[model samples]
Target: MRRLLLFSGLVGALASCTTASESTTSTKPDRDPVAHSTIVECILYDGMTKTSPQLVTVTAGTEVQITDTVDYYFMKARVVKDGKTYSGYLQRQCFGK
Candidate 1:
């Protein structure tokens, strides 16, 4: 059930590619390097809160790139840690900045 729900959410996220792509492309090619952020604490990835299907426990101080903000608590972000890049929904409150 968890995997199914996560899969469905990912499909929904893909359907909104225009929005995600728009935000991703907003990054400046020149001066502005991709902003870096770290998970200030552990966060529960309920899957529904994020659009990604791959469910994994995000540990404290994990580095990531904010892809877009979905609301006050949820954000579309790319997890960049341990030599892996994962795109998903991360809680904004869990980040250090």
Candidate 2:
């Protein structure tokens, strides 16, 4: 009876260890993909002035393909202009590249 109890205890310990290891190895997906279509030049419009238009020259189009799809806490867009690439977070209202 003592030997049987010892064997049962050992088996329980091994099962608990296996369960802990499996839980630790699990990973959660958080990053999400940004949807972008055609690239186009976007100008920032001034809200105060109604007559004259203030145009910010964006050399590169906005459309960019997402290399990976994951839920990123922040949405980032890469803009290429004047042979240089610039990366920045997308404004809340901006969409469709």
> Quick one: best lDDT, which candidate?
1
Show model 2 residue runs off by greater than 4 Å.
Answer: 1-20, 23-27, 30-35, 38-61, 65-74
Q: Candidate 2's error at 35, in angstroms?
A: 4.3
* Per-residue error (Å), model 2, residue 54: 15
lDDT of 1 at 7: 100
lDDT: worst 10-residue window of model 1: 29-38
- Local distance difference test values of all predictions, in order: 0.64, 0.48
